[model samples]
Target: MEKSIHKDQVERFGSILLEIGSLLMSYGANSMRIRVTLNRIAKAFGYNLELLITHRALMLHIDDKDDQHSFNQLKRTSPHGVNFRLVSGISNMSWRIVSEKWSLDEIEKEIERLKSLPHYPRIIILLLVSLADLSFCRLFGGGMIEMSIAFGATFVGLFVRQEAVKKTFNPYICIFFASLASSLISGLAVKFNLGDHPEYAFATSVLYLIPGVPLVNSFSDIIDGNIMNGIVRGMHGMVIVLSIALGLALSLLIYQI
Candidate 1:
């Protein structure tokens, strides 16, 4: 928002700022972090920012110090997901912007690059998450047999979740299906007496779908005084919990346990 810059340039800058904020919000960043990051970038570019953040959208206003040139935009964010790499990358890029003074084009290109960065291979993630659930089962007093059951159940459940997400299913429905798959698999222990701690295996199998990030972020948002956003995120997490509970209940009914 420098006085020398044309209104068109200011508009473009505003658009980029909105894009960055939307990306952060969609990638599971807390409201405070998104606001702070956008403000940091705007300040570095000699502008002031006012932001309205929500779970599914972002609205921003930008103006020069003298209020000569101004821009306002509202953008709908992408479906919420967790990608800490993108969030941290953008935070670092903002600091770099402050020091190196990048052009809008350069910043746009960097964001694109970050978007294209590949996630960890799916098989690797599957193994790791399943291992983590197995560890959780053991920690919950499950024997080795229960841990093995948990590992297999989590692997299948997480795979279903990945495929459902790729198909663009509703998030809650996807979680429901994943929890159902996991609990159904773990429920086998009860049907066949394969493990001594079948209850532990069953309970821990769906732990992978607990919506931990959203719950934690919601708490952080509330603590930081973003009340509405916090409530929305918390509700989102609660719906996921409900979906999981329904899945578990169905499994229990099927097993009559």
Candidate 2:
């Protein structure tokens, strides 16, 4: 009886480890970090896991290579039914992937799967709140209206199309809206002669949309030995910055004519 119970516990522990690993994968964590997190999770489950994570997928290493085959089989048996104890783990992974330059289709599929998990609504709310904060920071030079609009638009966007936003939304779109909104508002302010330095207000408002912080963070991440993560983040930041500049320049020229 004891032996049977021990075996059951081991199997449960293994399943939990896989679930944790999957959640970490969705967050944009590097393989090493994922493995470390898995180790901690395994410890929580009262088992010791030997795991490996690559950019492509995850692997479990057991004393016998054949044992890994059993683990893989177990994972395949119920890929969708695994109980995810911590929903934030999955959302973190989703955010990580979405921030990277991975194929949009793949990312969309992953997010779709993620949404099927429990607590998905809460995750979506968190994402929208972050986006709203980002938008407000980029609009109206930190005034009450900017804050109100950011909160309102963010809530509306999230509440209206939670699933669609999760499956099809792009962070860049949020940035674009924030920038464009600020510009239009500034233009109106200028028209009304509400302020003499409309250009400065508009420019300052959109400064938050600049990719400088991400770029710096990426560089720091790399310097700290997270090469893959650093490179991905840095590239994303650079692309966003360039795109924003190009967009603003084009808009200004078109408006001038």
In terms of lDDT, which candidate is strongest? 1
After the best TM-score superposition of candidate 2, give how far the Cα of residue 57 lies from its true spot, in angstroms. 4.9
**Number of clashes recorded per candidate:** 0, 4
Per-residue alpha-carbon lDDT of model 1 for 1-257, expressed as tens digits?
45556788889999999999999998989999999899999999999999999877889999988888999999999886799999999999999999999989999999999998899999999999999999999999999999999999999999999999989999999999999999999999977888677899999999999999899999999999998989999999999999999999999999998
C-alpha displacement of 28 in model 2, angstroms?
6.2
TM-scores of the candidates in the order shown:
0.97, 0.50
Q: For candidate 2, write residues 9-63 as lDDT tens digits.
A: 5555465556556655544444455655656444443344676443335567432
The segments of candidate 2 whose C-alpha lies over 4 angstroms from its true place after superposition are 1-15, 25-33, 43-167, 170-174, 190-194, 207-217
Output the lDDT of residue 6, model 1: 78
